[model samples]
Target chain A: MEHAATAPEPGPARVAELRRSRPRSPLLRFSALAGVALLVWAWAAGDIYESHLTAEQKGANLDRFLAKLTPAPVRESGDWSDFAPWAVRLLGEGRGAEAVLLTFALATAAAALSGVFALIFLPGAARNLANPDPLGIRGGRGGLAAAGWHAVSRCTRAFFVFTRSLPEYVLGFLLISVLGPDPWALVLALAVHNFGILGRLGAGVGENTPPGPARPVVAHGGGRLGAYLSALLPASFNRMVVYFFYRWETCVREATVLGMLGVVSLGYLITDAKSGRAFDQMVFFVLLGALIVLAGDLLSALVRRWLRYERT
Target chain B: MNGALQRCAGSRRATLLGIALAALLCGWLLGLDPRRLFADGTLGLAGEFFSAAFRPALSYEDPVPGAQPFLLAALRSLLDTLRFAVLAMAVAVPCGALLSFFASSAWWPDLRRHRALGLALRALHSTSRAAMAFARSIHELLWGLLFITAIGLSSEAAVIAVAIPYSGILAKIYSEMLEEHARDAQEALRSIGAGGLAAFAFGLLPRALPDIVSYTFYRLECALRTAAVFGFIGIETIGYRIRLASDEFHYREIWTYLYLLFALVALIEWWGAAIRRRLKT
Candidate 1:
């Protein structure tokens, strides 16, 4: 108690100095204020509560919906034994299995194609490679050559940004109309969006690479393309693969939903079930989609873990 | 050592080969046809769609006497989309924070110090993590469909649908960030007799706050996209307008809505980057 009483508190001068030393950024303040303002305005708009259904109607709808989710056979027989056969029939006769396979195929094809395209185009967006002074080589090209390289980099980046901004569903919606419901429409939609993401990610990986092995190729008077192929590509291959799997996981999720555009995937089946008011079938297909996503996530995680283990 | 390095390189090549083979197999299974890409009349439609990009609609292509102007309708839908996104984020952020708190193991007390409590906390952590995974397994669109089927497509249904998966995703990332940050400060707090949760709150949460905020902003951008997509199911966002325009073969009008969406996404992305930079400094 005597020692505690003798301990000096933080003096006013020290407290004032602490306040002065705190990190400050006007942009952050503005952003926080804007975010709050937006929230207030959104709440005041009251758009979220706009519904034609009365409370009673909504309650009834919910009750009916949940009741409908039980398998019809089980609901009638009151036996858990009926569920297995019903599920088996749904998987076999109802085209659910085919839809699942198609969803997986769509994701694989799109991700592979995007990975290929990204490899080809990402170098143009990579600052280290796109610069005239490639790999920081001394006395590199100047003036017009430098300007041309800069232009290519800028244009490539802009193109990636444009594609990345378009949501996959929006792209699929437009492509389906233009291409007339072909599977190519869905594949292309997924591919285009993912190409942008992969390109950007690949460019970042390339830029952040140590530039150790890659510099030797440049020093040996190799061209930018030569250096990229022989050194940077090999050095960053594992990292690129990791990003590919990450995007592929997302592509699987998107492909499941893309089928709602009416081509033929898990999403289409879910939508069809809903329109027919086969709530039981809808729930089954939704669960099936969830299973597919979980499987995809597991696969990607395993591959990423392997990659990490090998690298270390 | 040289032989081992060669073997490592060989395995890497084999992995690449395996991936390529898998892709080919998937392509074969899909039975993709090249002819369908060039199906009759697709070129004309594609040309028309591309051409419309340069001249987005300034007014209705086929004007109706009583209908509001084109720009005004686009503006309204844009605001609706933004409002829906904001509402969803409002629900998601706090829910995500709470979920992440339970999901993470970072705040757990020393097991030796409180054995029974530690076991309970461990159980809670696993349960929260499993719930997060299950919730995140389904896409938000499907969640929206489920909610709409159950509740009949109100704004609350849409917001909740978006919030569910977003919260799960945010929680997962937030927990990872919390775990990844250094625990020196937290340990110091604990050594001074601070409670586990208190130390985490004061010492660790602030260290992870900037990253968490940045990611939340990113999630808000995603929520905006999801909100637009929900317009397809009758939420009256920009996507609903795009659907309407496309049904009428109003390519120019569709482009207008698309450009508006793109502009909004671009603005939010820029704002997020600025905020992140500020936080870093």
Candidate 2:
């Protein structure tokens, strides 16, 4: 304890010293790329809606997509069309609790895998985000106020760069192209995307560790990576749990949408039902997906409370 | 003490790199290779096809019946794409937000709420997320295809395909946002005996409202893109038009529509960003 009293005060000199050196810039490149991608996505969506479907076609599509699968078959209705009703009917099959359970089970597994990856990525991110600047000093001159504001602005940029950089669909699109239509393809796609997401959160939580621990370790000849793991990761442990539960829930939604690659989750079921004109079954799958999202929310909430209880 | 290059030789990085390589391998198996066009002479054929996409000359003759209604048809396809995306966002946001509360930590304080309540809520939350995730995993084209087969080729089919997944996405994202801000304000509001609904309204809503709107716009943009892609299957959406024009050797129409789609996305981003800035202030 007495060893701490001899520690030198880190002031503007130290601030200037740290600021002179470069900060890693990979994060910046990723942010810019993400911004560009988002713009492109927006342009594509805006230019392509109205002319996609004709009035008559739109009516028939909606009806068929919503139809329910029955034991009985139906004759084709219009003179201009030769569309079959099997896809929607198969999707809109009977409302079995078992089907809902099966769907949820698959989605949960996917989410859990992403959560595990998030856990793996957290330690690395936390270390990289450790601020070298000392506490109680200004961010600009030598005061606390400047430091606080700088931190906020930098963090905000990072946050935006993180969340908006990649959409799940884009990831799914890329992965589906690469990994085929398997269920694991969707899972892997969601996982990589989630990795980027949770990594940013982990970095934010670890941003407050004082430089003392990291500086001392580095000065004593320890590697930068060592200082990061020891000082940064440990400091942010408390916040990791909260983000974990939250991300897991998100994975569930991603799993559903990404599963549109013919990987049978409830979404696949919905599409099939819609194709078969199985209205009731389509509704069932939609409702079922909604319900599963709700359950993930609750589970995460429970996990959060448990973490808080542990902390207390 | 160690060199940066030396540090890079760790087992973890190698493992990560290996895993990525495997994923790449799997991706290869999926047949998503854009290079396939060249190998099959498909690229040269595509060039010829897309050349016509530009043919219907951007003359004053367009929108007049004689030469080609190129400009008008392009504009019309663009509108349809925008409409599909907007409508999908409309359906997705509210439902996602409303359900987000249930998914958020704001609802469950402890794992043991009550004997039956805990079990029931647990089931409900899990099911909701699972359902959303699974639903969203499907592609819009497939969704369109599914709907097309069931309901026949129509805009409604496109809308359903887009909405189902976007809803899952919005709900998941919104819930995560809520949980990240679950402390303090929420706790204080709860301490005041605010009901769940009241606490959400008084404490959380204000902070999240702007972000929610921004993301909704973002999702709208995404849905539009997905809807366009779906247009390739059967729908006459912008994507479908581009594909059709290209297929029919109408390069001018294809270029016109594709550019229109790109422009619309930029405009939405600009407007959305402006609104976000205003809100921030």
Candidate 3:
């Protein structure tokens, strides 16, 4: 009791004192070193500091751009308009709503297509599922089947890596070239990238699923496919749903960006307004894009909440 | 119990049906026509693109008359892309860390005890949250375009454009992580009469640090991709070269640039994984 009364309270001050006395953690030291190295490399390689234009010219350019935010005088020669009616017209115009719908539609299609592809390829890419024990097979011919399955798994894994490594914007660019600036080009590009992501995630889920539940079924004369369908799929489906919703959120954002490629989406509207020098209209379109993303975010949140409750 | 089981099952079925219907509606709205997918010579064009992508122009000997070789140009653009992403992350991570301190509810637990302070803190929190949302809501590509218009085509514009939205995203994620993981520890510290910031620093930050670091690495990968996309707007990145090559029908050169971009992403991903493994240990 005496010792307890006499000892330090081990409160914030003590924590600070202890921290000050302790040597710097190796991780912290390593991170600092890495940060310094990165900064040095960035200094050498980044062009942000190396501008050909004089500072005054850059400052003037910034001022001019900032000036665009305010309404220009109503002249016959000018394209700018006052804020009130411009905003009213922006909301009244069905284009903004249509763009939101198009963005949603694109995201939904991409998610659906990617989900299908993920389901198809995930099994092959999962090592545990793809290369099940040969001894568990009914016949002695399991060796050849296992070898073939292993090859398929490797190929599927490679395909996922290849597709996912290429960003959707790059894919959109290539697809636009081939497909001639259609909505399908954006959809396909988004789908290809998402398919890779979802497929890899689903494969990870499959690889990590414990064999305990499925093993009994396999022992009871059920084929591996049957066991997988009955046990593995059900076990992983909830997690897959969670991942899908997360990816859907990202897809919504990507769909909006894809509009910059001349698609008739919110991004396209913003680009159009920018070119026309209608800053008000541009602001309106930007707000609408934000609204759509917010709504998508809200929906995802609600669905995730429901899923959590359902799981419990 | 039997009736309850049946009702639960019915609700589940209905939910599944609702989801299916929504998917169908969305698909219909998109005007997805399978027939048109391969029509109008798209297949041939896509085939050519794919074939050329597989066989990139790597030879330095076959240089175009006065132009730099494809490999050298691609490599340089690749470095530019890396630099852009790294510099942007450098700005974002620290800015986000600062913003997250204000944004996180757990960090301001004592606000309620003092009414005036509570109101001010609430306003600050809401304002910071709104600012982050606004920052992230605009896509990086749009931000890049806006920056280009604002400050001309300087690398500063590109870096700042990427940095703004990325910082917002990082701040939001960081706040959420702190809120989720630090609440209990923070409460304990508060009970011990620790100051808000001190409590967060001592109690919460360590618990949340792993997740924060992991998410940052993920965001860095994303930043790298965005940096490449900025190239499309003439940032002298790999995407710019890709666009130029594709426009000129130099598919081989496009592939070269793309392959380099892919390698960069792959390398980052590998590094991120290693860091995550270390964090786990």
Candidate 4:
């Protein structure tokens, strides 16, 4: 009865507290909009000014596009050249959109392709970790036996150190010369670099689950695979999802970079914008590329949220 | 222990077979008609480069000429890269920490409000987070490419463009750190007379500062490497300069330029870390 009385008394007070706690939504909106605006304005100023300079410096390429933007002869020739679509003339016809579309398409394709590659390449490694490896045994009767575990640990540690030390950029640079420039080359390169990251992340997930699970399975004389399936897989599934998203984000960036080598994609738009001397188009495309990545991350977050919290 | 030990023994044969096949493949690809390398007293071109590479390129008296231009160029570019890292950290760490207060559930007492606010905050966080992420994910090369076209080919655009994505990453990490460590303290502050923002500042900020600084330096080091990577868009940073020298067929100068960059990057990192340690003390 006292609990009920106290609850009724506090209910009105709690509602008042929320109103006080909430910041002025308008003020919050104003600040956020202003902040974003300020950054955009600053970036635009710098971006626009540089674009102008590049257009001027690059010479005749912009002449064709700029000329198209300028008013032509009064009596239009009715030829396809006489009348230009707004973005077409402004962006030098379809090239800008094409570049954007192409690169975005490539990134999407690469993500799917890599998933397939992972499914194929990872099973052995997964089994190796999940199942007991008689192959790892070093037969030594004395204290030398302890060294075996140490060696195994050292190898695992070294694998991580080597995998993460070099970013894919460096790897791409090294492989570019060795393999020569092929579209497939970049794909292989991206996959290899990403594989290192994925494997390390995967191993971490396997090792870091709660102890209760594996102990019970192992205590029952279950094999390594049994312990892993019973204990680790379920626990690590959450981490695996997050890691995949992170890798996908990295892959998107790599696909853009690979474009520099004439691999062709969205980065090509960036190159075209600069080369064609259309600074405005450059801004549009940069925003576009940024949006695509932003979307990917949002998707990842959505999945993570769904998995992380269960409905009471 | 027995099972674990047995596993190791089994992998050795596989490991040996893998090496043998790899060696065989290498020989096949390199035109390893072993008869030529073994029968003829010629060490071949690769062998020749390896042997020659071991010999030092310069003495105190005879300094390499092409080396300095490349090194200086790389040094200048690397400085820009380092600047990007520092500035990105500066921008991102605070923003990320600020956002985390809202993103986490510490501010809410009841289930209904928390769920609604949590969803909203998550959406906002993810979108902004995505912006920051994509900003970095699009390689600085792409960033450089667009910026060079739009903003012109200056080091400043390169730096800022590169920084945008990194800052996004930094913010994301910082938010996660805040979520993990400051949840309880933030809640305690919120339960009392403290406002959410106020509680976050007092409760979370102090604990997060050390980590922020440590991670900032870590990110700074990463940025340094990225700066070199930015050469693709013609930034003429250390990496770009090296590629240029190589194109000009100055192999010895390439090594020299690389060494200079290594020495400089190492020095800067050590100096920065020392300063941080001292500051912490």
Candidate 5:
């Protein structure tokens, strides 16, 4: 009887059986309605009909534009010699190597500063760690202290929201006006954004921490701060490191974007190449940026591996 | 045990030293100078910029002739940004889904049993993966600039620029989601003689659909941000106006544009959280 039940049914019966077993999903219907609404919105917004040029004309134009972007043969033989000089020029006069180094420096500085800021604000922001009365005190003194801590927690949370909401690009723009187009502007912008992200993540890790280790600290007459410092932070350290590395990856990417704002990074080279109509050079710079980002990703992966190995 | 502890301590020191050396080299190579940080008038300028936030221009006056009023213009720009983002996602999400179907290893369950066919499928999967990586490696800002150069300042350029990299990202993520969830279901279906596509549709897709939807909503929020950034490259979105105001020292106007952007992002964040919550339940 078990063997018979396990066997596949015939086609018609199998289809019916499959249909009967399928779970009802309202999400599908909701998504379809949302998609249709999006389409109607797009239509009304005139994005669908915004372009005046016909499709064929646009295609021809795009083809021509791409044709213009293609680099001309540098030598009669069409060999590597044609590209060697450009590469050399990019490294020497264009300061491609310097740009890469600067990008790395900016990212590292930002990550370091953000890590510090995140640590400073993390206890206050974390819902669990910031609890007003972890000791279950019922007196007037405990109530007042609890109220004060709650206010601090609320303020820190609001700070995180405000900082993270502003994009690094906007921050870079604002910083440039004040800092006079120096590298510090980009560094601070990246730091501010990542600080918020890391702090929020740290707070989340704090909230979800298992009570097994921290409870003892509190039960032993340790203050809330003592419990957090001795137990909660130690427990969440690894997760905080993970978040920091993740943010570091993004910081490298943002550093490149910040270059477009006149900070002498790889982006600046790309911008210059574009203005000069040197499409080949622009492509080269973009490839270089990609390499730097890939290297940063590789480094992060290695660090994560090392951390895991150490843990084990 | 003592020796082992000493060796572990030595290794930890070595790792720390290595990291410190790398940091030092990077800093030195970049000529990291902090003396210029406190340039003349820096504090005053920053103060002014911050103060403007509290007094954002809320007037109905049009900055450009024949344009809408201040609030109306902001709303219009927000709509445009949304429209571009949605259209880009519409293009990206389907293309990404199709690509992921080809890219995911779980979709090709017969690969191990059939050597030649497996080789072909594996090659296709690797190629698709590489293509997606290359597509997303270049940031959207670069893509926007490239499209602007390729086709001039047009909405199509903005939409296409946003679409390409986002499609790559979606494809990479979607493939991972499918692969992670499809294993058990795929085996069950294959045991019953269902074909790859059938197994995927009936088995893998349902389980992965929730995660994919949630991620897509998160990507939508990202796309909105990207669209605003694209405006800085001269697409006439909110960022473009903000840039204009900033360039002309109209800090209040910049704040106004920024507030609109913040409201939009906040709304999307709320919606995304709601959808994710629903998915969880």
Candidate 6:
């Protein structure tokens, strides 16, 4: 009898709370509906229906390509033994070994360069620091001072977004054109894109860092820079390193293909093989690139796992 | 306290040493020379390229008689890129969701209640995980090249190529999200006599849905970039036009296309952010 009386009393209030918590805003519904409509329109107007070939023709084309994929020497001798020597010769004489090394080196150099650059520039992008009163420390109360800080913050964020938006391949292509296909162009392209990403990520880390440690630094008159360097940086170091490794793994994958821009990496070798109509060699290089990416992934995962353990 | 501080300093120093060693190795392998960055005429070319970025072309840098307008060409390229990205996502999302179920062990029956079924599910889980790893190891561009080789470069082949790696990525993340969420609600529902799938759907899915959606949006953004990259292989996306403009030394035209791509990405990011905020409520 007591449960029934109390339940009845709170039922209406509880229902009201539930109703308020649900996402029933008309604008949200409209936006979701609009998104689905746009997708439907995209499919209707897409260029995916361009091929006029019948199904048999498509199958035949695939079969012909598969036939070409058999290594030429192996096909002639009808023996799998010829394949091993051919692959060994390809690695020894076709510069495959050098290209593999170059791919890894390019990724490491770009990742390290970007990590350094991002660390240097991220303070300007951090919301907590770019304000007039950093770390919640009161400063001169002037509208002009606030406006200036806001503009700086906005411009820095916009710059990061703009650089991040430019696909690395596109940037590499543009850079290679002006730089005459130099390795520097590839390195710069990868670094610039990753720098923007890391800057954004590192700024987020700064904003999300607990205010407790940083407040004491500000109270001691260490200034925003000192507080950031001494407190926030150390607090977020493991996370930033984790992000760095994640980006490095991506860089390795990208470096594998960025070589198709006419540099010498796994991608360049693969492209060369494709043009030479050596399907066997092309597939081999592609698999080798995949292997490198998997290795990079494993290494990054292990480091990230260690970092997570450190946090606990 | 003193020993802990010393250990921290030692680790920091070691990390720095490792980075230095890696950078030196990279420099040696790449034959890197700082002097080459400022080689003769390089500064002039770079200056010309950056200057054009400020004044993106409103039309063709060099006109040809009776040619289509530059803006029309750019618009077409933009739409094609969007279409390709959307199509790839449409295929990848469903495939990924299906693969995720097999990959994730969260919904498995209790081992004590059903030993044979549990072992079989474990076997399926491992195989799905291995497949996902292999699929994700290859970059989408490489996958595109492989598909083009195998199937003669049709639109379907291109779409499939992009979809393959994307599905694996989405599946991996989705499974992780499912596994990461707290199982309190699921356990409660199960205790109340709900079916296993029902308990998972109502309890876990709701908690993980927002993250899964947010990640899918991020993947869509990536797909747009990948679609542009596909143009290099002759798919008539924005990258294709950029390549064409570059070939003719039309840096301004390249910038124009680049700005359009950036605007599209920024708009999508804003929309995704707004949706995520709403989901949080």
Question: Which model scores highest in DockQ?
Answer: 1
Model 2 interface root-mean-square deviation: 10.3
In candidate 6, what are the lDDT values of residues A112-182, reduced to their tens digit? Answer: 99989989888888988888888787866679988888888888887787788888898899999998878
lDDT of 1 by residue, A56-141 (tens): 99999999999998999999999989999999998889999999999999999889988999999999999999998888986366
Candidate 4, TM-score vs. the true structure? Answer: 0.58
Q: Which of the two candidates, 2 or 3, achieves a greater DockQ against the reference?
A: 3
- Candidate 4: regions farther than 4 A off: A1-145, A211-231, A309-312, B1-84, B87-139, B176-182, B195-198, B206-218, B234-236, B245-281
Error of 6 at B24 (Å): 2.8
Model 5 agreement with the true structure over B1-281: per-residue lDDT tens digits: 89975775566567546646765665566565666665557767878888988998986333676766787777888788777778888888988887787788765656667999988988998989888877776777888777766666677777888788788889988987876673687669888999887887888887887789878986887787777777777666777777777778888887887777767776766666666666656
lDDT of 4 by residue, A1-312 (tens): 877777634577888988788645453465458546644544443321122345455455444445443324312554545434544553456455555544444444444444444433332344234333312222223455445544554555444333343445654554455344534445545656566557655765665566566656665666555666556655565566567666766676566656656545555565666566555555555565666666666766785576467310
Error of 4 at A260 (Å): 2.4
Instruction: Give the i-RMS of model 6 in Å.
Output: 1.9
RMSD of each: 3.6, 14.0, 5.0, 12.7, 4.9, 2.6
In terms of docking quality, model 5 is acceptable
Look at candidate 4 and tell me the lDDT of residue A34: 53
Estimate, for each residue in B107-216, the C-alpha lDDT of model 4 and write its tens digit: 44444557886677668657765555555555556666645443356656666676666666776777676666646777688778788668767877766666666666
Candidate 1 regions off by >4 Å? A1-10
Worst 10 residues of 2 chain A by lDDT: A130-139
Query: After best superposition, candidate 3 residue B132: deviation in angstroms?
Result: 1.5
**Which stretches of candidate 6 lie above 4 Å from their native place?**
A1-6, A9-21, A52-57
lDDT of each: 0.89, 0.57, 0.78, 0.53, 0.76, 0.87
Tell me the TM-score that candidate 2 gets on chain A alone.
Answer: 0.58
Q: Is the docking of candidate 1 incorrect, acceptable, medium or high quality?
A: medium
DockQ of each: 0.68, 0.10, 0.53, 0.11, 0.40, 0.65
Off by over 4 Å in 2: A1-312, B1-12, B27-43, B46-68, B105-124
